[model samples]
Target: MSNDTAAQPAYFIAHITVDDVEGYRNYEKGFFPVLKPSGARFVTYDDNVTVLEGERESGRTIMIEFPSEEALMTWWDSPEYRELAKVRQAAVTTHSVTIVHSLPPR
Candidate 1:
């Protein structure tokens, strides 16, 4: 693909607090399948996360890296993911999701 199509890498961050563990587990089961096809990589996922500095939301924090913004959006907007999201929405008490562009290499 051309550079324009292949663009810069992107990352997705989500801070979530689960109210229903079983329901969240169900969401987890279907998470990979939707992400795998879009080449998303799990950078980190931690429930026992600590705040080194500044304000941090309460809950499990997850960071996922994608090959590009397009890939990230594709995975997020996919029909499979949409279905899985309902499970996530029903399970979590708080959910914050954001996409960030990676800095260019020096």
Candidate 2:
């Protein structure tokens, strides 16, 4: 969060199918510490995900909220997360990772 702020909130949505259970557990063990530093907050984790529309893989859903899009990107592109992601990369098949920005305040 920069001082000269013109930032809007952001949400990260991810849909994934676990490929290796043990690997995913390992990934989870290392996930939070890396995530917290960026000021992003976990919103939800759904195992019984219901897809109401369109064609998309349905297994697990994860949502994270950030103070700003920049903060989300910073965490996403950080070396720590990148390195930790190797575990997650090997653990699951990611269907989507969407970034939704909040509408500007009126």
Which lDDT tens digits does candidate 1 get at residues 36-81? 8998788999988878888876789899999998888888888889
| Residue 101, candidate 2: C-alpha displacement in angstroms | 0.5
> What alpha-carbon RMSD in Å does predicted model 2 have with respect to the real structure?
2.3
Quote the lDDT for 56 in model 2. Answer: 66
Against the true structure, whose TM-score is highest? 2
lDDT of candidates 1 onward, in order: 0.86, 0.88
Candidate 1 has a TM-score of 0.87
* lDDT over C-alpha atoms for residue 69 of model 1: 88
**What TM-score, to 2 decimals, does candidate 2 have?**
0.89
Minimum summed lDDT over a 10-residue window in model 1 is located at 1-10
- Alpha carbon lDDT of residue 53, candidate 1? 85
